[model samples]
Target: MKVSPDGQPTADVIARVKDIPLYREAVARGHFPVLEKAEIARGFPDNWMTPALAAALDAGEAEFVLSTGTNHARMQLIRPPYFLLKSYYRLWSTHPDIKETWEAGCRRVSLTTVLATEHVARVNAKKRGEEPRPDPRPADRRLDARTFYLNTRLDPALWERADVERMLAEMAEARQAHPQGWYHLDCSGYHLAHLLQKINKWGLWDAFSPPASIIHAYEFTPVNVRRYLQQHFACPIIDLFGSTELGYLFYSDRRGRYHPYLEDMSVELAPVTEGSGLFHLIVTSVRNPHMPLVRYRSGDCARTLDGTPDPAKIKQFSGREKELLESPSGPVAQGDLDALVGSVSPHVFVHQLRVLSPAEAVLAYTTFDGRPLAPRQVAALGHGVRELTGRRCVLDHRDHIAIGKSGKYAWLARDGK
Candidate 1:
């Protein structure tokens, strides 16, 4: 289905996006400028809030939530069954490696980064004139009493004693109805690592059943966290990539290599002018019947493995363009740091590398359970940074890596990004 030059979608495309008030003028002009966050956030509820969409929300056909990353509060969007479950029921539950969890009829548990709770708390606190306090412990595993996150995720700290007991009780009830001990652990890589750290500390490793698999999404997983999850969990650890505005786009195999999983969607990488070899993700998705965003700039960036702007060769989804750091070697993306950290050691749980000057840098890092890196490992980490950025560096062992005010991890932090 296509739109005519007269600024109208063919009978098919129009059947979905046309009646939407926000696209009325664009649809009439036979033109659709890319959907920017600012524009969508500015015209929200009024623009895309078509009668159909409104009806869907009221009738429980769709769920509403705000984007966590935006200049303003956030753009609200509606989804059918929320994005996560929508993707799972639509794609992941059927993948070869993932089919077992589905066939077992396992209970699905989601875990996102501890950052979400921390960041959402700060935002909510500011709104209520409450001062947010920093989590004294570096793990950032504490959950905010107030609810945060889209309807898609469970709280990061949901595995606490009371919660775990409750979960077991529910599983017991389910077993009584139908015998099944299998379950799926869905979470962010760091939170899974955090949960494992907590379990080890509490000596509760064997108290719980092994999951059929661990599905991690939401934020980019640190190399160390991914390694830890795989080593500790005797199950498939799958990595999913996508956003609330869009459904699942990509996922990773056990080797941590990403492969596209687009359905009713296509993607292309356009060279970003600020950083050579870096490209902004351009996606055309018609998957959602209500909001068929076409040629939308997703605001995320990545690099090609072979220096070609080919989606087939995408090395990494990297990070947001606004967060790109000006490195002595052009601009450093988060994926660049992730690669560097992986080279240093799999035990490096969390790291934040800041460029201090052309000749010097500092890396704040944490290891699994506060395990100190050997002098050789520290030397290797410093050497990797110097080789990549042409700068000598020093290591700073953080008691815990600090989460952004928004409860996100910035592997490459610069100028307070």
Candidate 2:
């Protein structure tokens, strides 16, 4: 529970670190420094594999897994199987806005990337190791007793009418599976927005049931997209902030107010650059018993309400540290551009900032209604972009902005890098 002046853990963190073999040399060297992914990858399992940890692995109490590599490279991790799910369930059951539905024992329908579904399938197949089971059904991709996967493809934008209908039918089946006839919906915000668009276009609303609560935990949700989801579902729509390694670290309520969900963890914010509002997320957590992390840089960037490193005042999970762009003005993050676009118009769906040169960039976007922005709104957004990046901004309207191969969207793009 004790934390340092900067929100990093104090005695509690040291106690956890003192017992981990991986931290012995770092601890002996003097001060416990920030731990990077490179340092973690350097030694692999041997670094943290104590006798107890190895025994746990053998006993299937813990498992070795790789991160999704969405934000950065795939990170090797060790923790109990379903560690992330347990964390997510805890948050869902305790979050004020969603507790009642959770208490009602609602089923879970997950609509995220097909990669996630495939990863689970691969893991399960490898674990089974040739044990025969019933043939897998194309429509039935259940992750657990309560959670069902609905996305069978990578690109939501490319989902044909048949695909949309199948997902809706699966959702209806998921709802009926629970005795209470209720289910909590979990999804990537972008995926949900795309699904909504498809549903509206195809008039498939009747086939889909309104979830008791909705949590978008997979990736960053644009302000406009969040607004778009709000306009359709009357249920509580929340955004969860975390990673595959950390689980649900924080979550936003129905009102879009953030609350920390750090049970056995602490956080610190170190500025990306001196005098810059942007800060790198540094966390000290003992949540994962086999792989406790101290002063770990999560590769995420954020901004506090007053531009200070008060963890409670964390205003935005702006973007990844690696993706932050150096602008003539200073530094520009995905969130900064999002704020400008959202302010200009809520119709903007997805946007990508392409830096052409040091002094020029193009903002390509798609609208919810598939129409270009008004001339005045376009001019306003262009002006804001120019001021933020200190570049001549060009607004380009597009019918679609492609998702990455990983089934996520990159907000910033620069040639060759």
Candidate 3:
């Protein structure tokens, strides 16, 4: 394994860790020395536990357990030391630009439905008189709602019609009370658009104050969607990249380009198959001492604008690795689909493309809570998919699409085994 000048393992760290007999023995016995080290490093109570991670942490029988999987398969991963989370916070909070954003009291809303937000929502719901609602959705799990936003298990129906109107009214009232109040809107790209649509339906856009900025994390944001949101709002729309295990890794600047936030993490771009500009991302993060993920396969796809992984010169974050479609004409990446669909309906989430044949495909997706795509938008999505794949694709709306056991949205499912 190649260690950086600072003695931290590069992506090659995985191999080095594997080669360590003591470490291997500990892991083989389902003992997480890394977790213990992390706990000690973070100075937490010896028994301190993050409720969201309790299930995985207590599973002493598994060498590694997945913290999140979403659309991709769940990863039973080595846990990094708990101190790694602190390292991430220090890196992000101390960054001059990012710190300015955070210290300015800019709302730091997380737009993802992963464990972090789920935990918060669960913690928050306990403060209410009601029991946390039962979740039938694939992503629903009992969360500590006191610390999170809305619970992931809460039905989309709860945010519908009257409920949405009330929320918008409250937002408007907040704006009125504090003119300089900076609102931070965060979530999946699809959910933010849905919120905007609800505001629009109520003719509340003009009445509500535009947030100081908007951050879209967890999934790829299509180019057209980026343009549309930026054009409509007078604030900056930022896209961030990271995972549950890694936290935030990259953020877009004012120029609408991604810049690396992790000085300890290095990235490499490899071709999806062979001799293709389409590349897969491989990462080596050194901050997580408890569970260092070296050259961890993130299952995301991208193509460097300049064909290299120079953090300072990154030009774009294309899309997910598995979401690409290979057609006779060329490959259609998820960003392309995002662009087409966003043009049709910005509120669509959990998009999946299934190939029935070389010339036929099916598109399935769900709308963001409190919003629905118009019939015209659905037709446009079908037409766009057909045009991109050179195949007639059918667009279908489902009441819900199952989230993977890993709690991620799978955007593409190939037909047959």
Candidate 4:
């Protein structure tokens, strides 16, 4: 458990790294460097893909697959997709209260939370009359929840008539795929919250059956939006924290507590500073035999146990490291802001805290149309920020939170890195 300056790999990580052809020489040198995404991309198929691995992917195996991209732009990884899906399923199957609805079956439906940026890029390229490369064989053929909603993007008028009709149609299709009332809702929380809010607004609650479980990934879950889902659905709402490169690593429980579920992987928290308790999650996952990420910097942050990086005691996975804000007290993470807002009222759907300077900060946020944060709630938020970061902050109420062109939201957007 002792950390080296370079974060030494354990016997397991070393053994796995040695198995990869690319890392064989580095392993022989008796000192392995961290596996970086940029380094991995220098020569993609040649860097990590062996003839056997490439052939397997070419042959179309469900276990070995490709991804579009995640919140982080444009980086693709080839790994087992369903491997991540089943991890959540198994976690749900083992949980006590959380498993009540989903225990009967693993039936599920997926609603994509992100726009297919890659597809849009290709469409734009075609408009300019440039020949875009064809999608790799078999990789493009695998179908899952994302297949249904890749082309659409969310916006202010996301649930409008035409949109509502389309959503209802998609829901009907998903329902037909799973007739049982109790099922898992694999979706983006933002999309689901908006859909549920619209359903309530249009009085369409009875039109569709409630899902037994709701699993939201792809983006940071806002407290207010989560509250919206909790209020509407009787099922347990869980957050699966992971990326395409690394499968499901941790998930949130009903109590908002994060529990570790590593699959042939080990995680270490390397402190961002001396004793910040916030550390970079350096993961060594050999689960992907082709690309065994050893001491890979995930660019994600978390508060660990007892000011130490105890894998089992990960308090929360804040957003990306570059997205974190510098404050007078210390660095403020997305989870830190989430706590400040969530405590006051979980209904505060979208919040963006901009650090104007060391002395001032502005929190722009919105809630459901009818419910507003009370004066006390506003005061509590300001008080919490002041206590947490020693900043003179105030809540700037917003009518609506705008989605980016990518149909994604930024919980933390700063002036500079």
Q: Rate the local accuracy (lDDT) of all candidates.
A: 0.67, 0.85, 0.56, 0.68
TM-score order of candidates, top first: 2, 4, 1, 3
lDDT (tens digit, per residue) of candidate 3 on 252-353 = 765677777765576665566665556666666655544555555666666666755444555666676666789765677776676577677756655778
Off by over 4 Å in 3: 1-66, 76-98, 110-117, 123-148, 151-158, 169-179, 308-313, 329-331, 339-352, 362-410, 413-417
Q: What TM-score would candidate 4 get against the native?
A: 0.81
**For model 1, what is the C-alpha lDDT against the true structure?**
0.67
TM-score of 3: 0.66
TM-score of each: 0.77, 0.95, 0.66, 0.81
Backbone Cα, N, C clashes tallied per candidate: 5, 0, 28, 1
Predicted candidate 4 versus true structure: per-residue lDDT over 233-330, tens digit per residue: 77778888887677778888876788877767778787777656788888877776656787788888988656777778887777778777776567
Q: Of models 2 and 4, which has the larger TM-score?
A: 2
- Using lDDT as the yardstick, the better of models 1 and 2 is 2
| Model 2 pairs whose backbones collide | none
Clashing pairs in 1: 7-30, 111-186, 111-187, 111-188, 115-407
Q: Please give the lDDT score for candidate 3.
A: 0.56
Total residue pair clashes for candidate 2: 0
- Please report the candidate that would top TM-score against the real structure: 2
